[model samples]
Target: MKKSILAIAVIVTLAFTSCTDDNNPSTPKSTFELKIDDLKGDITDGTVTLDPSQTYTLTGALIVKSGATLTIPAGTTIKTSTTALNTSLYIGVERGATININGEANNPVVMTSGQAAPKESDWGGLVICGDAKVNTGDNGTSEVGGLSFGGNNNADSSGKINFLRIEYTGAKFSSDKEFNGVSFFGVGSGTEVSNIYAFESGDDGIEFFGGAVNASNLVIVNAYDDSLDFADGYQGTITNVYISGVSKAGIEGSNNQGNDIATPMTDAKLINVSIVKGADAKFTAGEQAINFKEGGGKQTYTNLFVSGIDTFAKLDTGSGATARIDAGDFKVNGKNFVSTSNLTTDYVSTETGAGNGATLPTWATKISKNN
Candidate 1:
């Protein structure tokens, strides 16, 4: 007689099973339990907390499926190893899932490469997907993980990220499909993100895709692309940002390109920011301090201080962008050090913002942990 498959469930210590998320009840994913020294896989249920004393290495993709939470204690370090072409080696939280990175000011959580000579694009980076609204198609899919994101819940909570530093991230899988140092896909304002640092990313330091999450105290260093980017009808409020050594624009804001008249256009409001044009001339065409294109929506920058290079604002030659700007929908408001000229009338000479001029902000002082 053949043994029944149900009989093996009671005797198995580590059982492999399929799980369905509440967000998308039809989609199924393989689930597994994470063990020390090997912290990667689909967490399907409950909350798993990492021991700060033990060492953890991410060898593959760690997906926190819906209805699960992954908690990293303060002073925890998660070293990662990845193949040159495999961008799937990342930590991602799906819709209805949560990841709590609890790092302190002095003892922060570090996520970096484990190679002897680590370089840029060594591995993929952190990705959080929530059910927040987006102007994309019915659902937006991520390039790195192929996960479906976007919904109508603007108050959805993905979780909290605090005092964490991620280094050597932003792996590229294709010409257009690449990873940001930190990517928030349709995340909501209920999530708490603060004191995060991005160092030496191959793409943008941090990116938000049609989310309402409010992020604060962010620092990006040596970003290969734009330091900060938001598109697809994102309505988020970011505060206290410091960027340096960027090969592209300091900030890039846009909306839905396919459907420029989509509901709830992108609204970007930032305060106390400093963007310094670095010496990385590898991309000479990347000479825009702030670039608004593709149906650019309302953007307000307050107490902004920019040093090195000129070109305060540059608008792309998109039909939707031009129409939006002409209609005052892409109006720039706020007091800043540089004069945007025709872009904004609210310009003032600002010596420094975010409590420090072009230097690293005090809130992002935990960047030392990743180095």
Candidate 2:
């Protein structure tokens, strides 16, 4: 036989090319090289879910592994860490961790900072560590300075985040301690963050500490700080927010220990919100708009549409700081709260506070066009 049929046809053509390279689905068995200073430590035990129409392109810093479940499917483009001290993505989620970034709103799923034009310290965003349960000071000091970060044990829907779009993040190391494009420390409230967008941030583009979560449609633009910040005792339910504070100012709801030092107890509930201060230019100290602080407890404002310059709203050095305002056909607040929060809305007052250029109080324009 001709060398036994050429050694059985070269072992059946090497077993049909090894079963066609094991049924190639673009075959990539192992080539792991996740770098960016190896992404700190234990980002939720390494969970990577994605794959919902599959498209992942992370260059570095891709840590999400606690109880492992990082599913980001909705146009995914997670690229960061071009080394500004290893930029962005430091999501340290532990205690049975989980991260399910279900993006939408025209396929929104991007946690960027691998800079081309990125600014705001250029990196670090989206840190959610929720065990869910607060008020730790009674023998259960619960590691704040030591920094384990994450609540006691509560909010459980098995951890889910919704319709996201985190852009141009805040990535500083000092001075108001940057890095907040969506950082919900101690995130409880049955963990399911909502329609989020923190664009062009430098800091405070969305922060809720001491969790009891209930967020809704937040959109902050050009932030430097305070585009919606809540501190210790963050008993939450922040609704329909739309902030356009350009150099910072437009909701600095605080209990402030800087943000965490057991800074809870601000019990929040703001609805149909709209804060516009220095919309894009003008800053002296950024200007204030609805700043309530320490000695905390109590916040309930309905239908607000601020147009700012300076002090459109104020409450910064706390003591019996309780809020309950329902300025319905909104325009800052009756008689135009000191000429519509005076930094500049073309001042000297003519008063038209909502919209039609300003004047939409038909149930606050049907609750701002049904949110």
Candidate 3:
């Protein structure tokens, strides 16, 4: 009887399964638990709402094209195949598309690997592309998907993502193009992003490339590379972030790769950040907690707490970065800009208090206990 019931469920899944590259009504719409298998296409101009009570499998790239939306309710679980080749299993929302993840603090949406003992690089992670401002060009190609992004609108809206957890992701597309836990490419200020957690990512936990989207209440644990990375003329604000057990820098910032003096230079402000390296951390010989390289950007750090790291801040001398430090363009610890030579001696292993009255969110308290 049990075998018969399982067989019936498999038949129902196959009967309703539909896979296509273009927009059409032939796609499956099932209210019951749906098993998406080997789906190698796009969801164009349509909507896919996952049931919170059911579990879904993603075996290939699930691209939400223009005018499409993918909605995940609270307490939803979406697992990606670990055996997929060449970073196949991932989610990509293109320009004009939206992904509404309405997860609550107690019932957050979870996206993880399908393997039993999941390790790093199990699958590709989430990718969001928007038509916001970027120094790369009008329509620059993204590093992971080669999708076109970037425009003149600084207020472009991709959608909302809240109370989400991504685990064991960051599959490499190529030697130089590896996916982050969450990649925001040219995303804008109109989008709402908060309460995100990335765990055990093979690459960076979160990366913003040429975007103006502000984020808050972020947590990263056991990241193989930098926990947070900002590049390509990003002009966003980050608040209340915590990073632990990072192999590389806790925060890595850079301007445009091609043109160092690009318009809207990477001017990001970080508040109430804490980077703690555990006893068994995997840091390199000369790794720092904050590293700014390939400059022509302005960075402001306030009320930061960094401990158990070899170096606190490492600012590259090229690209006039040292000049920016002297000109008060980069502020540290609520003080005027100063030299980077004393950053380690001044800030490393120090217990700097929180920013003003900043406090960690409730969700962060629950997640930090596990790390």
Task: For residues 1-371, write the lDDT of model 3, one tens digit per residue.
Answer: 99999999998786666443245546335322335554446877667887888777888888888888788898888887656673888889898888899988767888888898888889889999999998787798878877778998889999999989898988986668899999999999999999888988889999999989999989887788888999888988898888877688888888867766677888999988878765573655145777777774888887778767756677777755766667777777867655556666346345442332223445485434242
Model 1 lDDT on a 0 to 1 scale: 0.79
* Per-residue accuracy of model 2 over 1-371 as CA lDDT, tens digit each: 99999999999999888777756633222223333334333343334444444433343344444455555666665656565453434454544556777766656666656667767647667766566655543122212112344556546433766666666676676674666777776677777776777777777788876668788766776677777777666787776677664465667665545432234455677766766664345432354666555534556655666665544545443233432222221123223232233424344123333222223333222212123
Span of ten consecutive residues with least summed lDDT in model 2: 138-147
Q: What ranges in model 1 sit over 4 Å off?
A: 1-32, 82-85, 280-285, 329-351, 368-371
Clashes of each: 0, 29, 0
Per residue, candidate 1 scores C-alpha lDDT tens digits across 1-371 of 23666567544633332233345454233345667777778898777888899778888889998888888999898888644344857899998898999988878888888778887788899999999999885488876787778899889899899989898998898768898899999998899999888888999999999989999999888888888999998998899998888687888888877876676789888888887776667643264778886777767777777766465677767777777666665544332222256433123225476658777766667655334
Taking every candidate in turn, the Cα RMSD to the unseen true structure, in Å, is: 7.9, 18.0, 10.1
Ranking by TM-score: 3, 1, 2
Residue 216 miss distance in model 3 (angstroms): 0.5
lDDT of 3 at 223: 82
TM-score for each model? 0.85, 0.33, 0.85
